[model samples]
Target chain A: MPAGFSAADFLYILPELVLIGGAMLLLSLSVLVPRRDGLLLWTALATVAVTLVLVVRFFGLDVTAARGLLAIDSFAAFFKVIVLLSAALTLLMSAPYLRVEGIRVGEYYFLILCATVGMMFMASGVELITLFIGLETMAVSFYVLVGFLKPNPRSNEAAVKYFLLGGFSLGILLYGMSLIYGVTGTTSLAGIAAALRGQDTSLVLVLAVILVGAGMGFKIAAVPFHMWAPDVYEGAPTPVTAFLSVGSKAASFAMLLRIFVVGLPALAQEWSLLFYVLAVISMTVGNIAALTQSNLKRMLAYSSIAHVGYLLIGVVVRTERGVAAMLLYLGVYLFMQLGAFAIVTAQRRSDIIGDELKDLSGLSKRNPLAAFAMGFFMLSLGGIPPTAGFMGKMWLFGAAIDAGFIWLAVIAVANSALSIYYYIRVVVFMWINQEEPVGSPIVIGPAMKVALGVALLGTVVLGIYPQFLFEQAEVAARTLQGITAATVVGGQ
Target chain B: MVETIVFYTLSALILGLGVAVITTPNTVHSVLFLVMNFLCVAVIYVVLEAEFLAVIQVLVYAGGIVVLYLFVVMLVNLKRDPEAHQDPRRLSLVGLALAGAVLLELAGIVVYSYSREPSAPVAAAAASPVQGNVEQIGWLLYTDYLIPFEVASVLLLVAMVGAIVLAKREL
Candidate 1:
């Protein structure tokens, strides 16, 4: 016990601490409680609710604690809310499917909670080591989640592919960190920025930054490093797939923003060009690849890669407005993507697994409510106006133009237009095409219906009134301004 | 001079072990070689004066993860000759060329880096006592890096649960 290290430090981290504690509690309770039909479902909902409340209360305060490695700032708090809500929604969507598939397990919710904790820490991470640990935590948990249905050969294959690719990326990232550490002799982001000021840029440092960018690009499923996305997304359980696409991807972007904006601002001239090239490549490749994918999940996976390209446009600008737009885009993306996946979860049958594009044909006739929700989600994703997805892209590309990257913004808009073909293809098949009734109308439970409704409402409302999220994004962007501006000024 | 010789020798051994781990035909043999490679890495960590990390490298990577891999390989009951003989085809030729290209690139970078005018050693021996020792690292970990340290533990917890869930059918 050292001086000034009180229980107060632990209290500041109470939200994350509580989630970890809750996971252990749930693990024990799973044994005590009867393994009824809905036991795991109810426990998961309760855990997410308690964790969400803790996040809200923690964010309500205007305090920074844990020696700055963890910040209770609005930026981390916002992402924490997003991750929790996404996990809760995914769990809600998983209930009926898990029951149908006979794959219910207490460890499922525990892993989700733990992964959410990792995401929260990722957003708040102010140091390189913290970021790496958070990333590995998230990755390891996801590897298991992807392979949870171990008896299924496809699930096992997905897990192995994800783990190998993820492990390789981690090695690259760690190597980059070691290089940075060699140059700065420190792991703290603030210290690294300070050390970089006016220092003659070394080739080692430049290479290190590139490697770091490559690692992050892979995590976000950007082009050239996105080879694993479609297979992993297709093979994983639908709910886990939804969580990976939304919660984990958003967390990676959050960490990327923090690192590039706060830690490596002095090298903006060097890194921004790299981001620009990557953004173009990601958008072009992702859109072209997706045009041919007939598998719904695989297309979404490629579309996700393209979406990462759009988000990279924000990072390339290296401006406060760009950060805000990126955050806003991620928030909107959470709902739209999760909502689409939720509908897929509902459509699952005993014989058929994922909802292929053809499977969705004539869905409008069979389940009009689900079809309408899915339609809204697709429209939003395609960047159609008056949808949250469109508004999100608007903010992102607007920030790019504002930062004088008009060409990059133009490319993104073009990519957005190209995306519409495939996105609308799903809608057309759902509404216009016809297929035989495979089974009875899928009975969605109360929790899933509510989750879908909320996601739908969020998509429409955010699209209609983007100001609320934009304002929060603005504030979160400003929180890092002190570091960014100081670094730029010092570099000059 | 003696220290430099030892460093080079250890580096060569580590590299050799790494190559063996990758190219070995037997998966079990490859895993065993991986453990050896990990142990060599731990020795390198010790030489670098990262004592805590060295211990962790041995305990976690060499001891735990390798054992897990061995268990999986055993349970899978792979056939004695799981893979066919390597073909001397165009693809293999291309792979060899790519490997050569990578080696040349690395060599170029190393040569370029070392060509720069060498700076003074900055009293490496004296600095070692204060900076590279365990006490300094522990202080840093407890102070500025504390939150990440704790979060890493939580991450491990999640990983443990995840592994259990993946490997077992029931809770």
Candidate 2:
């Protein structure tokens, strides 16, 4: 073995390999199978299920693969499972939505699988280069997926804008990575942390940190770096938007915590201050912008940005409880965000785009079930009591308070209150505003129902009985804390 | 002294070409300037003693990517990219503020570096191993960085498939 490397290292990424193999198989079957209905969907779902099981096999593991380039720990495993679940949910909804869009390509599922695989890598990657590559994989798949609707000029325009802006942000990210490498002479997070112990804060390092923040700010759709998000969300195929909101956002948060907490714990005060500003501004801007949107997708996009801001409060806190709070919030967020988008996808038809708020008017009359699910998601998103969103927000803000950041908790609470207005507006459109008839009788396919059920169950069940999720999130966070503590001590 | 002058001349040329690539009004001229920029960057790689990197940069970036750029330019068949919509707001003050921020950051970096003791040890730069550049890189790629290398290949595969999916006329 070269430098204590073993073949067993490949065992650690077996789940990722399974996903890659399944993706290739999907693309190949697209060519060879000569099939049409539900074949790709079932296969993609099977791949996700298998990958999820494989990832669960690594639960509670705390080993480094390939000599610390990737972590195979409970922390990674937790994010991987959540990411895979979201991937499965996205695919479940994609069947009917893809049919409605008249796009039944095998490459569609393949790209989703590929993006999932990329996120899987992102959750485990311990090195900057690995994380960047994983980030690119997810980003590129989205750029193409956003434009999957070729005939629609809006889709084309969104794809171009996303590609250009995504490319620019990746450049900024890489430049920051290069600067860090220049200073530390290593690309691994632990290695960089080890090198920078007790070092004086320098301007170059500050610039590098800010650039990295800006780059990741684009990924998570924070304010001032969030110009591309609403347009991309509104223009993308609905399923893609759901996956982008939940899957991409969750994975990027994983990478963010990985970089900041697991690596830069020595500079906690500095980054804590930086993320404090990021949290406050993102919450205020995202909620304020969301209130004025007439388009449901655009509203959800801004709402998702606000949700991201709420999640950033956890990063600002940077304790075991904080990390656990983020994990809990993201878990519930996946369900609620995807559930809302599922309704949006169901409303889409051949004639009308059906994303306008007016399209949702009188939805309760057309389909009370869908309207009810949408109501649950909206309430959860607004952080009302007894919803998963509320439970998740409580833990996050509670952690902030415990960490002596009471002001942050207060700001987050105020923003959550402001956000309820728009969330309730969606509900009011569905139920109270009965004058405007929904143009057509809405149809809910079995696949979409399953997807919605999964999300609804997650949002409602986790909210009411969250002990299981709470315990698991703490175990996952414990591993992260252990590793960072070891690194800090070892470095000194 | 000679190396210093050479490095500065190449850097200045590369920066100028980069500016021209983005600023020039003509699409074809812009692409050709990009090609020149790539070539100059490859030369810089050679100057840094990474001959393999220089060759790869020439082959991949200057040769391969430029062809793709030309293909896009030809397919689009536009003299210049048309602006679809302009922001109603004239925000020159915002631009000026951003420029000032960047300038201040750069000055801070310069001043901080200059104020440091010249003999302060740079602990991060490990002593280079006595091996050929290509050999060292290859050995590391196959061993220490094998995972990232594999991931890069996967990324390229995605880009390839995505390009085909987006480019082909049919679904």
Over A93-190, each residue of candidate 2 has an lDDT whose tens digit, in order, gives 88877777878569899999999988988899989989998999999999999999999999999999999999999999899889988898889998
CA lDDT, candidate 2, residue A394: 91
Give the Å shift of residue A431 in candidate 2: 1.2
The per-model DockQ list reads: 0.45, 0.44
TM-score of chain B of each: 0.62, 0.65
Off by over 4 Å in 1: A1-4, A37-39, A57-64, A486-492, B23-43, B50-144, B169-171
Best-performing candidate as measured by lDDT: 2
TM-score of chain A in every predicted structure: 0.96, 0.97
Candidate 2: which stretches are off by over 4 Å?
A1-5, A486-492, B74-130
lDDT of 1 by residue, A1-492 (tens): 243355767876777777777777777877778575476667667877887887776553444567656666777777888899998898888877777677756777778887887888887887888888989888888998899877789889999999999999989988988999899887778788888888887899899989999899888988899999999999898899999999998899888877877787778888888888999999999999999999899999999889889988877876778878988998899999999999988888777774688888888898899999999999999999999999999889888887778788889999999999999999999888887766667677798898899899999999999999899887777776655564332111
Q: What is the lDDT of residue A41 in candidate 2?
A: 84
